[model samples]
Target: MSSHADHPTVIVGAGPAGLTAALCLARYRHRVIVVDSPGAPRNSASAGVHGHIGMDGVTPAEFRARAWRELSRYTTVERLEDEAEGVSSAPDGGFRVALGSGGTVQAGTVLLATGVVDVHPADVDGFAECWGRSVIHCPFCLGEENAGGSWATVADNAELAGMSAVAFRAWSEDTIAICPETMPGLETARATARSGGGDVVTGTVRRLRHREGALHGIELADGRVLERQTLVWTPRQRQQPVVQRVADELKLTVDEAGFVAVDASQSTGVPGLYAAGDLTSRWKQSVTASTAAGAAAADAIHMAALLAAVHH
Candidate 1:
C-alpha cells in the first residue's frame, strides 16, 4: 500500500469556495492541497461574476486565473489538477483521499467544495447556442447587461413563474412569464405577472429562436412566437458525483436539494469534514456568498487547530 501523504487540510474543487478557503488557510500558514478536475465550473457559462464588489463583471475564467496567481504567493498552498475518486476517514482522525490519477493523500481536515451541475432546459432548439449570452438563469447576475431589453422567464411551475415574473420586471419593463398549461396556480402566477406590469402565457415552449447565436424569441407548441431578446430560466441542479460519494462515505446528512448540510460555521457534523459554496447552499449561490462561507470555514478550522495544539 502506498504511504499516506499528509497535509493540514485537503480541499476538493477549485471554484470560488475551495480557492477562497485555500487562500485563507494558506495565509494562516496551514498546509492545504487543493484537488480539482479540469471540467468546466458551474458558472463558466456566465459572462461575469455579479455582485462581487471588486470583481464585478469579471469572467469566471479570469477570476480563477487571478485567484490561482494570488495563491502562488503562499508556498503552503498546493494545487493538483486531478479528480478525487474517493474519500474515507482514517483511523487516526484524518481523511484518506484517493485521486483518479492514482494518488492518495491524508489530511487533518477535508473541505468538500465540489459544486452542483445545472440541468438545462431539454428539447429547446437554439437554447444551447446562446445559453450564457442571451439565455441566463439569475436576473441579478446578467440583468444589468440586458436592461430594458425584451425578456422572458420560463417557469416549471406556477409559484416560480409568479416569483420570477415579478423579479424580472425589475430589469425590464417588457417581461413575460411563460408557464406550461399543466402547471398549477396558473391564475395566481398570471395575476402576479400582470400586477408587475408583465404578461403571462400558458403553453409549452417548443424551442428557442435565435439568429447567429443571438436569441430572438421563444416558440410555443401552438405555433405562436413571442419576441424576446433575453430568456431567464432556472435549471434544476444536482450535486457533483464526488459530493455524493463523500456524503455516503462519511454518512453525512444532506438537505432535500442534495446540498451537504452544514452549520452556520460550515461544519459538516463529521469531525474535520467541512463543506461550502453551492454544495452547501442553493438560494445564495453568488460568488460573494461562496467566498464568505469559505472564509468562515477556514476560521473555524484555524480555531480548532489552535485548541488541539494547546490541549496536546
Candidate 2:
C-alpha cells in the first residue's frame, strides 16, 4: 500500500462520479483515495435510479453497494468514510485535503465530484416528506414509474413552469403547470403548455397532500385543490458547502449559473484539479452522465501523466 506521502489522487464525494473515477484510476495502476461523507446520498430519497442503462431501476443504496464491491477488487484505491472538511495547498506542489476525522490526505491531483444540493421549498407542509418520491426534480429519473398519472409542475417562474409541464406531458397528458401570479412570462408559459396538451394555472401552493407515502393532490392557498398524483418541482440548487469552501480557497472559476466551470477534459482551469458530474453541468444529472464524466476525468489525468513522462 502506498503511504499518504505518495500523493495519490484524492477524490471527494463517493457518488457515481467519484467511485467511477476511482475505478478507472485503479485500472490504470494509479493510486487513489476516495473520501465520502457518512450520510444519505443526495438521491437517497429516490426510490430507484433511472436512465443508468444496465443499472436502471436499482435503488441508490444498491447502486453504491455494487460500485463499492467493484472498487474493492483493486488494491491501488482507498476509501475513506469521512467528510472532507477543508482543502488547501500542500507543502509540495500538490493539494492537501483535511477530513472530518482529524486527518489529511495529500494528493498530486484532485478530482471534485461533489454534486449540488437542492434547495427545497421552505414552510411547505408535507413537501419534505414527499420529496424524491412524489415530489421530484428530474423527469427522466421518476417520470416512467409515475407515468399515466396526473402531474402538477410547480415553479417559481413561468418559464420553468411551462417547460416542466410540457416535459411531464410526455409521461402523462394530465399535466398542469402552477406558477405564482406575479411571475413573468405567464402568457408564454400558457401558450407553451397548451401546445403540449397541458395547462398553466396561476396560484400559490399552500400544501401538498400525500397518503401512504404518495402525493395525491396540491392545495392552493385560496382553498382550491388541484388533484394531482405527482408534483414536478424545480427548486433552486447550490453547490455543496465543501465545494464552495474549496472554490473560495483555490479561487476556482464558477459560472454565472453557480456551477463550477470545467473544460472538455473536466479541468477546472487549474493544473492537477478537476471537477465532474452535476458540479460541472446541470443538463443531465443522472448516474449515466456522472459515470461518463468520471471516466473522462480519469482518462484526462492518465493522459497528462503519460505526456509528462514522455517529455521528461
| Top-lDDT candidate index | 2
Candidate 2 local distance difference test against the native: 0.86
Instruction: For candidate 1, write residues 117-163 as lDDT tens digits.
Output: 88876777877788878888787788888788799988867777776
Residue 268, candidate 1: Cα error in Å is: 1.0
Instruction: Report the C-alpha lDDT of model 2 over 1-312, residue by residue, as the tens digit.
Output: 232224789999998899999999999888998998898789888889888788988999999999999999998888899999877887778898998889988888899998889888796788989898888786788888888889888776777767765667678888898888887888998898888888889888989999955999899999899899988887788998888998998999998878999888999988889999998887768888999999999999888877766786
Q: RMSD in Å for candidate 2, one decimal?
A: 2.0
Model 1 lDDT, residue 261, Cα: 94
Q: What do the candidate models score in CA lDDT, each in turn?
A: 0.85, 0.86
Off by over 4 Å in 2: 1-5, 163-165
Listed per model in order, the count of residue pairs whose N, CA or C atoms clash below 3 Å is 0, 0
lDDT of 2 at 153: 83
